[model samples]
Target chain A: MISSIFPSKNFFCLNKLSVCSDSFHLNTSLFYNEYSVILTFLFIATILSVIIILFSYILAVQNPETEKLSTYECGFEPYEDARHTFDVKFYLVAILFIVFDIETMFLIPWTNVLGQLDLVGFWSMIDFMFELSIGYVYIYCIGALDIH
Target chain B: MIVLIICIVLKILVVVVPLLISVAYFTIAERKIMGIIQRRKGPNVIGFLGLLQPLADGLKLFVKETIFPSNSNIIIFLIAPMLTFILSLIGWAVLPLSKQIVLSDLNIGVLYLFATSSLSVYGIIMAGWSSNSKYPFLGALRSAAQMISYEVSIGFIIINVCICAGSFNLSFIVLAQNNVWFVVPLLPMFFIFCVSMLAETNRHPFDLPEAEAELVSGYNVEYSAMTFALFFLGEYANMLLMSAFVSILFLGGWLPLVNLFPFNYLPGSLWFSLKLVLGVIFFIVTRATLPRYRYDQLMYIGWKSFLPLSLGYLLLSVGILISFNWLPT
Candidate 1:
């Protein structure tokens, strides 16, 4: 699957070289070739961040007083803890978002096969959308869309 | 294997170094533009016209104390910024700077971008949750809700682009725009997309979660020094990423503005970068000009307005494309 996407001529040489060396090596490079740049990016980012973290550890002054480390709520003293009950409105909104987000995700595959799916594709999406609209209306009617 | 690893590392450096420098300089650009807009000198004391301000700022932050709240979850708190920074950088792997220049060039390039962006929300959430503080927690909740709200609309807009372009590949999306950028025909989408992009990046006007008055700097309020710097770099990098997205998806990635005069002579990356800068400038101008939205107002715009608008436009474009058989192969 990976090879199918990165079918560049360079892959051929990389593949041959890996095959000649070791099977385990070939597997990694095969995955690497398809996404090596992205992986390398992640690696570099992690390294860069680690360096900064270490740099700060060395240079940054640490004066850990009780007041300074305390949770900031204006300049007040002890109150209820920060981890109190969250508003349920956030949960309701998140659920609503997930439903539509999944529906939107469907559009990607649908659009990819659009021409091949043709009229059937079009109507199926319409039906899919119709159902989705019903869900939207249900949420709206329930005032889930309303800011609490 | 060794050579292959070396080559990959070199390529990563090539993309990242310039990106880091730009992220550094963009801080200056934002300050300068905001200064001009506000009739104030932003920061000219650090270097000639404050040319070295980002360096100075970075050094200052590097040397500042990192405050770890005694009550905070130590590991996750530290990891959150790193996650954000990494997620932002990884998106560039699929972006094409020019026809000849790209890092990975995945078949599902746009999807890769979408995935990375969606994942970035986690960083904010982690920062908020792990902080073990109320303000940061509230900020994180708001950010997560906001991102999800806008992402749905953004996904629909992207699907519309895919429907028109007929492929998920970013280069193909750009190539389809060669004759005419998508902004010309799909003007409403461009508007919705740009607005959603603002929300997506938590920029001004839509920066509800980070409203200083209410949230005291949102999810990263507890962060300081290098940890804070990582988050800062991540946000700016995401801004650049969104700018690149706009240029690629709507402005014709590396295409010359016009086929005539000086436009055609400039290199493709230059053209790409110019459009990107224009997008960044638009963000800056909006920041300078508009007041931040109330949290409720931001939600209303994302769901009630942009969501339906983009969804309708997606359906409309699909109907027109199929009827005219204009769907790309």
Candidate 2:
């Protein structure tokens, strides 16, 4: 049943239990600690966070007020819907972040394999860095990152 | 099967319970320390030295009626704080308490932490939009953009650390520091990471999100009762998590300072906690001392300053490593 839930190319071994094999194989290269540990942690965290919220939710008394329920605008009624309150600057910030962020993402895998990549890999990444830096310099010159 | 399930659950509980407890105490500590800086008594009325203040605060928040805005989108509003709290806690699965004490010794530990921290923005966006309020929406925009901007530089900072340590695995990063902590060599990068960390966590000097004078408590302006408590908990938890990252990446996490008699006499986990406290103190002191950066200046520093600086440092460090044939495996 466990094997069907998280099928792996190799045995999915927890700390000691090998759910995918006949016997526990501690030495199996297929240590699923990394793979499933996050799933377990996320699962537990979700349950725990929800439980903490619910413990309060269940214990709290419900008091309803129309005035309290209205959106807060410091004693006055909201002049405009918050959703309609848009800033064009934020969109630019978001766009610029996504562009450079993806560029930086490429560095992660490169760093992991840097030793095997040798000097050729070194210069190539440096070249890429210069290219990105030029683009960043251009972005800065144009005041793309600035907001009032 | 039953035994395995029980064991997994137990291990998770061990990590999560202490984390939650420390987050509670972390709030109390911040208040107490901040009060001392300002020459006031901070929350000493509860249990001895207000150690139980967080619990009391939790109980008080829990008992109050939750006020949901009539104009708000109810569903996303509910999910937002839950998402923040969960994401904050989940990063710990990859953080090492000691050499063998990690919940997940994942090869991509750094990446996992990066992803979780980045994803935290969505919670704020969802909450602000759903609240249908003025300040929260504005606060959310500032915070979300601020976090996103700083995260780009933080990514480069991690690359700088990874180049020195030679693995995305956080444990390898820690163990690689046995001969010397990354701080001594990468002090500039370490300082940049700390500044970016402050912006990332929305703490003081960069806390435009909750610049109460302007934002009136920011993106969580509308949240009340337990939901607000979740955001509070999530913020502190993120602070704790970021501090742990600093310790692991730069301060020789879990490794004894000098590995000498007194420091080594204490356990590895204890050392890790001490470093975390150091980080927390740093956070509080910055909060007390530094004035909040204006929103525009905050953007200027994140992009124009830290971003360029970190990217250059990553390039230089990697270049140096390659030239010296010293890339760690």
Each prediction's TM-score against the native? 0.93, 0.93
Off by over 4 Å in 1: A1-32
Instruction: Fill in the DockQ of model 1.
Output: 0.42
Task: Please report how far candidate 2 places residue B125 from its true position, in Å.
Answer: 0.6
Q: List, residue by residue over B90-127, the lDDT tens digit for candidate 1.
A: 89999999986888867678989999999999999999
Computed on C-alphas against the true complex, the DockQ of each candidate is 0.42, 0.47
lDDT of 1 by residue, A73-147 (tens): 778874777888898888877998988999987777777666655465578788888788887778768777778
> How far off is each candidate at the interface, as Cα RMSD in Å?
3.4, 3.0
Pairs in steric clash, model 1: none
How many Å off is the CA of A126 in candidate 1?
1.3
Candidate 1 achieves a global lDDT of: 0.86
> How many steric clashes between backbone atoms does each model show?
0, 0
